[model samples]
Target: MDAPERHPRIVVGVDGSDASIAALHAAGSLAGPLGATVEAWACWDVPPGYGLYLVVGIEGFEYAARQSLEQALADAFGPELPAFVHPRVVRGKASEQLIEGSRNASLLIVGRRGHGSLVLGSVSSACVSHAHCPVLVVHAPEEAAHRKKGSHARKSDDGQ
Candidate 1:
């Protein structure tokens, strides 16, 4: 016998950043029209110097991730989170977890950039390159870009 049908799922990375918030909104918009369920994920992992941090009582990684997830959802959906949207906190690398999630998702959505301290490509870039499903990279809002430029201009003017 054939397997029963399932609703399409859209996986989006939620990192509590404005760009990520935009991604969540975009995912929600798409989900409604596509009849897909949006799965918003906030992923976290131990830093490289985990041994030292562990001694310093940095064991609240999961809690912190969950907090970010909640905040992002609130920012994206206001008081009422859409019924089609589900929030999740994952304990792993963002790119790896999102890529794994893509295996079962109809679409993978992410921000164009994130607040990670990566020396190379950002998580969205990695997801675009590696996700099993089609990936959508939502850019930071125009006002944010303008604010960033204005701040840079002020700093440069002061330096000059």
Candidate 2:
């Protein structure tokens, strides 16, 4: 007898930013109708420069990172995640880890900007360049607001 096929996954990079939250929603929306799973990924890393500081309390850092991922997932979805969605916290650079995790995913989703910058974030840029699957970069809320304001301004100018 043949084994049953597993459900496909829609991988998403999440970091508690407004953009990441948007990406999570996008992934969930896509996963629902497709009967796919949503993998919410978050990575935490400490450079060699911070080793001394980390050595004093590495366990705490790990705990906090895991908590952050869990909290982000809860905040985006709810206290209880849907059966199709799950959260994972990995230890590595965001871009590299996310790229590796999305290898078997049907779609890889990320926010255009994370907590790092006002513009496009490095992780999103790296994922766009090197993801194994199709990539979807969701825009930040502020960017949507800006676009809306710009369109309204254009309409006023046209009316003048």
Candidate 3:
């Protein structure tokens, strides 16, 4: 029979952005020492007022989310993802799905602003405020994160 299931689970919210990639890496690095499994979630949904266009269905959005998740995983853990990492793509508000996932998780991890504004993202904020478990918000490395956000951060404040 299989070993008894571990109670430790790390749920990470990934949106294929640099920040999310950082979160995945963080979860991976921590999972082993903690004897936990990482669940990386990439969630997507149709924008408001796009119901007409979406009449065809939601497969496209779901597919894109899956692709993003895969790419992010590759970026985070290289070509071969860690065996302890279980990735998932779900259709719903990220914050809600992540919160729901946290119900049985020991930890919930999210990027500070993956595919979002400079400050704390709506999804991250919601997770911090409502997730059932402890939350860790990670920020991506400087260059990649800022580039994806459509801006840049100077290494020196003097504008060198």
Candidate 4:
């Protein structure tokens, strides 16, 4: 008899940045091996301090943000990925949306910003701090290697 099905859901954040794309790739690799469902999420919102807020209104801003989110997901996932990969778009603070979604996810994944710092973007930092599940901060392999080399060089120079 076949074994019972067991698969965890992995959540990932996408924002069209190289970092986000890297995160998606990492999540896909893990999902494929683990038989897990990959949920690609993108969150959108207008900054509250913009003067255009009065003209755009909350509902209007939400509508635009949602549309952008949908387009972003479509562009990122396209039509080639497996059916088990699901795409989601939400309107709200990225951190809040990600943390809430993490409630049911087995793992969360995000990319390190292009600046190559552990200081995550606002959204990623929040997820790292508060997500209920394990979170993987994806970085380009070259970046990881570079950081390691830099650290080693510094240690050698210090003679300690």
lDDT tens per residue, model 2, 22-134: 89889888987889999888778876688786758666656777787787787778887888888887888989998998788889999887344445678988988899999
The digit string of per-residue lDDT tens for model 1 on 3-121 reads 99988999999888888899998998899889999999999988886787677776598889899999999999998999999999888899999999999999999886644564224
Taking the tens digit of each residue's C-alpha lDDT, what string does model 3 give over 69-94?
A: 99999999989888899999888989
TM-score, candidate 2, is 0.84
Best by TM-score: 2
Question: Which sections of candidate 2 miss by over 4 Å?
Answer: 1-6, 114-119, 158-160
Model 4 stretches astray by more than 4 angstroms:
1-6, 51-54, 57-79, 114-118, 155-160
Give the range of the ten consecutive residues with the poorest summed lDDT in model 3: 149-158
Off by over 4 Å in 1: 1-3, 55-58, 114-121, 143-160
Better of 1 and 2 by TM-score: 2
Whole-model Cα lDDT of every candidate shown, in order: 0.87, 0.84, 0.88, 0.78
Which tens-of-lDDT digit does each residue in 1-160 have in candidate 4? 9998657999988776667777877877788788899988877777778777767576776566556545545555665756877877677788899999999999999877735454677777888999999999877567778889999999999996
Query: Judged by TM-score relative to the true structure, which candidate is superior, 1 or 4?
Result: 1
Displacement of residue 35 (Cα, Å) in model 4 is 0.9
Q: Could you arrange the candidates by lDDT from highest to lowest?
A: 3, 1, 2, 4
Model 3 off-target regions past 4 Å?
Answer: 1-5, 114-118, 143-160
C-alpha-based local distance difference test score of model 1: 0.87
User: Residue 153 lDDT in model 4?
Assistant: 97
TM-score of each: 0.81, 0.84, 0.82, 0.74
